[model samples]
Target: MLSKASTARVVIDLDVPGPAISRHLYGHFAEHLGRCIYGGFYVGEDSELPNEGGIRLDVVEALRALAIPNLRWPGGCFADEYHWQDGIGPKADRPSMVNTHWGNVEENNHFGTHEFLALCELLGAEPYVNGNVGSGTVREMSEWVEYLTRDGDSPMVRLRKANGRDEPWRVPFWGIGNEAWGCGGNQRAEAYADLARQYATFLKDHGDNKLYKIAAGAGDDDLRWTEALLKAVSCLGCGREPKNIFQAISFHYYTVAGTWEHKGSATDFGLDDYYRTIAKAQDIERVIRAHSSLMDAYDPERKIGLVLDEWGTWWDVEPGTNPGFLYQQNAMRDALVASVHFDVFHRHAERLVMANIAQTVNVLQAMLLTDADSGALVRTPTYHVFEMNKGHHDAVSVPVHVIERPEAYAVDDHAMELVSASASVKDGRGLVSLSNLDPEAGLEVILDLRGVEVQGVVGRLLTASSPQAHNTPASLGAVAPVELPVNPASRGTLAVTLPPHSFATVTLTL
Candidate 1:
């Protein structure tokens, strides 16, 4: 009864050359879109929930617990339409508008610059603001940076004083624009690159926080856009290395539930869709490979970081929630995707310096989703995945090759696999984490270590009875991580049965 599928043989050697991996890739995104702000992050001043200056204490505590290193802010497309001015000074006086792109819901400028930066402070996260390069003026973008960072006397600085923030808050990381090829204003790569240069130069040095100025990169798999940006730098007659002009080149890829237009529901989708999403999530590796190779040809020193600022599973919104809100129920499939993603990032940690799961809370693939009306918190499947992979964050990534029969599966226009794993040696230990996709079939494989010898395996597994299971607020334990055994059945190999569909981490003592 699929016994071979459960036989896992692995080998290890103590001494091996390792790759130095970056730590900052364990990052997250916080947008002003929909409930990502209001109900998700900030519960307002008068609510029964414990809060600080309108931010939820529970949310803050949870984010801190996640150890989120960096956080991108204020928008997806909202930044392009945002005037940082509207979010400063007074909340009652802040202007409001209908978020035309997302549900036409009213966006009261209440949760403005101060509220966001404050949230960042509570979480100890560096702020990455996306500027309005498409719709707003050069002066507006520049002033916003000055207001947040400049200590010297200036109108913007004075405005900061008037707004009750005496000390300058260093908003370090900045994106020159959002999706210039799309919502941030659809323009030719050449046109947007020139525009990016202008806004970046204008938002120049503010003594404390030197603006990072990340340029909008190619959409998923669109390499021409990246190439065009590399060539278009000369357009800014006052030239610099395109790499030097921007600290990072931002690329975005969302694992859509179906097609982008009608992304399928987060829950209730069939097994085919689940396998397809996992397969697509695996493509992020290829996306980074293609983009990194192009950038390498241009700047081999790897000066410019590839920032995957916007990513995560984008399934259909939950029923009754505003579709514009982009809320979706999380599942073990998402947890598996998260585990797979950590492995992908661990593989390319040097070049891919930072990445943010599409959002932090209550929106697409959130970590902590709250039922605001009920004052409840449901840890998403993605949350469990993050918790499982936390060990790989700042560790040295080691390569682990998979050799097995039940590997790659061909489906429709995409291909998926039953297994994905990454090994790393950090601090004083070796870590091997994996996610198996075949729900009905457990996996049997060998992890061969050429010369390195590891003593034992300490592992944990997040598994469920079925692929379609989920955790509602009332019933939270539909799926969860359980500790696995440490005993090795063989001398030079490891044998363990992976659950139907699960995410597990195996630690080897060197």
Candidate 2:
């Protein structure tokens, strides 16, 4: 039988200061795919469901609860095919087109730029717009930015006013294209970089709305893509300008347990699959390190930020949903994945300015799932993981050193410490987030607090009966967070036991 107990030691020092974890690190992505837009966020202004100007009330409430910092929208691949004109104007006059990249369903163009910006306003999140670089022209993208950000009486501005939105919306983050290595254009790095510059040239800033242009970066560990794109942009020779034309470069990575064609089921996995997924999730650090090294070589001062614009687990489509919809059930495995990734992000918070999980709703590793027919929504285990980790947003990183571990969890000759953790200080307190990756063993962690006085500690944990435990519309509370009793600090050490396949967050008043 496998060992049932694991021991780990964490050492946190208060004097050492690290990067300020950008709240944008907790950002979300909303693609015009699956039910993410229509059934998930938009229920139509006339629908019977509770809504605020066509946006789902429950979904907005949940996102607001997390204090979601930013939202990227309009496409993953759809941005390339999307015409800004098609999504503006009266809903009755708007055109419908086939979403060839996702489901091949007809997109009525109802939930267009206006709807997305309105939703962002509702949730109080920043809007990150991905412009079309594949099938769209410089003029189209330029005018789209003008329509949204320009308050002057230009043609686009007039059109915006005619559509009932008089004032311009501030869109600070803009993508030249998404996945130029694949979906956006299927172009080589050098070629896409050239197109990105051309499009970004005309995407001008209006008033105080300065655009943070993001170049389409590599997919996974493709270092060549990073080198070529950054080199191409560096050749621009912006002699006296303080800012690079591309304010940031994006990277996309998705964790898949099996082959892309036959990724294993979301909820039907055994210990082997579970271990493999954890191993895959751990690759984020290596990917970031490798790509960051390349960024350092080209732009040493780190003027351009690395945006992990798209990420999360992409498993087999949940049993019967439309395969193209990319829908899946998020379970305990997903919660662990979230914890592991957030820890990695926190450690590298300096260079990595922003990241958006693959999707925000009714899709890959979604925080919330909405029933199409019933309009009922369920918060997945991943959602609670975000909730529990929210304290780290905009907080200063408190360096955590894992002092020792009793044993390693090994699978197929690869081993990982049973407990993964990170620490940060916000305001006057300290926040520590931990995850126990061992499927069958609970981890007892003894934290050695040095250079600080701990007045008190409170804990919250998210765990379930099994790795497959998840929430559905019929059972919304299966994977929610509960208060975990905190052990009193004794002689500068605090002890806590993490249940198997669990995540916990402890806040210390210092």
Candidate 3:
């Protein structure tokens, strides 16, 4: 490490190709909790906000720009208790229910299956539906699948026709349950593993729409759930060919700077708090690698994929907001968290096929925040990070070896790398996403481009005056990406300086 300037050497090996970074890895999640489903994605037809079929147009347009691959809906803990039938009928006639897991608020069942699918269609994203396993029966789960994907005449088909849709919607991902350890069902790992097998058995595929059944696995460092599920489903001694009970296993990890009892405030925090959050965010790489190692012991062929369905920073709600809403502001700190996460996700793309950030809008680390009364929309700092890294979608991953780097940012004993990076190539073009995790010092990075011919380089940077800097409806552009000048390659290497608490992406003309 250079004392004058925190310097690093990142080797982007173009010849040795890695896994295809699934566009699905850049997915977002929305639940029925708080404003995420209601005001977040769907306003009523009579709303003053411009909408189609009660889905917000501005939000759809903003997300469409990001080219988000898939959207997980009606969940977190809400899926286990949600009764699909009650939400399917006419809006005026649909039954109202208490969202017990979130706030004790009554939901009018306005945004049902059709509404969610419509939102996905508008955004050009696939739909991932989390099914109810805690309180729903096998028949109920089976019928829901048939209703959404069956083509010909049947009970579910007839029911779908009566509700006004003739053709089936293509739903590629289906979650068997969510977080069975706690809010989902408080069941032991062994118990939930058996239940997952039963539920997965009934989730049949219809027409040409194949369902990638994902079983709810574990959270945090709990590896027993994954082992239990793998053990229960393993057909090692059956003499016949091994059959996967589920297509994928899921896990959830959230970066809380403080404990769950008192997650630090979103907009108010010290530099130590910022570094602590970054340290926590960096833990995701370890978690993913750990989970991937476990999955390998069971399925060496790599037939199963790991779905990080819920992630992102979980700060305390903004003042004067309902605690159950989980509504928090997004800051430059959150942007770095996202940037570091993507770098880690790229490294594990071979086993990690898809990941969805906790909640999409007006929820924890949301991309956009909406004003229900004024119809105002503001894109958060996290949104810019996603937009800036859009070039990596469906792109082939490449090795980013940080041989020379700055010292880790240490908060007391916990230390996190000061620099994080990932690279990819697609169609003769290449992209390098870099983040300087240090809050007080800039880092000079030299891209050691190898095994590929480089032509030119352009860059854009997202940063703030301070780590706590955030966006509001009043100051929407307080934190956004700005053009960064980059000199052409010098001896097969591209050099750029990253500002503190910032994320930058350099596009390479290869």
Candidate 4:
């Protein structure tokens, strides 16, 4: 621990009491891709496993605990070819189709629209459905909304009544399409933006749906696509542009070993690989800045939102598992990446509205992995970051300034800080969240809390025994968080030593 400089006053503004932040940013995505749905979230009706409406009960219970804010369904590239109608009605009578993108496996239309929305209900999560635009028509997309959210007597409305849902499910957020740059049809940005206006106009007409249509956007950190989409969509009309047209502008980024095509091994990697992957993961801030700058230039009031719809670490599949399944082990590395993303999002919370990780179960960077055969399930280390950061959700972003020794990672032309922190005050409690990304060297942080101590403080640490340590179904509790011992509260300052490659949080209720 280092010596205290001055007692810096820490202030928290509770008037920033925003609508309890939607937990969806800390949400999960589930696609028919890999075993995310059929074998992951769903257990067959005939199976011996315990299930509610053929959906795995254990997986549901695990996800429910995480308080999954929102669950994105039928996505990645899978949403491109998905037909809402094929998934409704009698299970046996439904036609089976091939999942062209994921595993090249057959997808029985059994666990369709109704089942997905039902699962969201069981987990107490809001439904965020991705509409098919690459292969499906405007009419098709509109009808899906009507079927899921429209009531009364129309063709789509009548179908919803017959499909066992007499009332609308209140599906709030809708993706106009998924990844239009590549697997999602690869349309040029200008063309996609033009199509976005038309699709949003049609889908927005559904009664009481009030669907917040998210336009399909740039892949990874491509700022050009963000600029093109913003410019094109803004030209719709003065009142119809940034402020009214699109509710959110989504960007997708997956941090892996190398290039877009050949992602390296997921499980068996070294520390260098781990550091490099996270270094790349942290580049999302640059992408957000580029997009935000462009949006600010056009609409300084900042009406349109930024959404990180697809994110997380993509690596080679686990041994004895299908590569397409994205079935990799979750470790401290994944947890740190999750922490990095949340910290970045908090910095951009005003503009970065909603974010859903790549997937929930048995997919790339999943929060929960399930094995139905053994009735086994484990919450990934990434899950801990979400649990730890739940305190910051929807809370005001209190400004934090770091003046102590600041180390930087040096590359050819860029550098990122080794110490990062953000603070927020909620319920009259001051919470300081810190992330130390240095691979080595513990940081001696001198916290100045002058004129802010009325009571006590709490500290929780999420540090791994070894960088390579991971949690499996058997050792699910291995890489958990620990409470650090604290000395008596100082008059106005406290000294704390943070271990390398870790994330920690401190709370002060004054």
- TM-score (all chains, Cα) for each model: 0.93, 0.97, 0.97, 0.92
Point out the higher-scoring one by lDDT: 1 or 2. 2
- Highest TM-score: give the candidate number: 3
Q: Count the backbone clashes (under 3 Å) in each candidate.
A: 12, 0, 0, 2
Question: Among all windows of ten consecutive residues in candidate 3, which has the lowest summed lDDT?
Answer: 234-243
Q: Which ten residues in a row have the lowest lDDT in candidate 2?
A: 235-244
lDDT of each residue in 1-510, candidate 2, tens digit only: 123347787899966899989999899999989999999999899989889878999899999999999999987999999998998888999999999999999989999999999999999999999999989889999999999999979999999999999899999999998898788888988888788778888989998999999998989999998887777656334432224677888899899989999889889999899988998898799999999988777777778899999989999998778999999999999999999999999998989999998899998999999988777889999999999888999999988998777577676667766778999997899999999888998878888988888898999999999999999989999999999877854799988888899999999999
lDDT per residue (tens digit) for residues 1-510 in model 4: 332321122233323432334455787899998888988899888878889889989888877767788989899799999998999999988999998888788888899999999999999998999999899999999888878887678898888888777888889989999989888888988888889888888885567668788998888778778877788657433544354777888998887756657666665667667667777777888888888887777666678888888899887788788867778888787888888888777778777888888878889888888765676788888887887787776676665556655546764345756766767666777677777776566766656654455377788888887556678867878888889544443666655567777788878776
Task: Specify the poorest-scoring 10-residue window by lDDT in model 4.
Answer: 5-14
Q: What is the C-alpha lDDT of each candidate?
A: 0.79, 0.89, 0.90, 0.78
Candidate 4: give the clashing pairs: 265-316, 266-316
Tens digits of per-residue lDDT for model 3 on 1-510? 335548888888987788999999999999998899888899879988889999999999999999989999899899999999998978899999999988889999989999999899999999999999999888999999999999999999999999999999999999998999999999999999898899888899898999999999899878888888878766433434235679999999999989999999988999888888999999998899998888787777778889999999998898999999988899899999999999999999999999999879999989999976677898999999999999999999999899989877677677789999999999989999999888998888888899988777789999999988988878889999899877644688877878888899999988
Please, what are the lDDT tens digits per residue for candidate 1 over residues 28-105? 888877788888888889989999999999888877877777788877888888888888777788889777777778
- Which candidate ranks first by lDDT, i.e. highest? 3
TM-score of 4: 0.92
The residue-level lDDT of candidate 2 at 307 comes to: 93
lDDT (Cα) of model 2: 0.89
Q: What's the true lDDT of residue 464 in model 3? A: 91
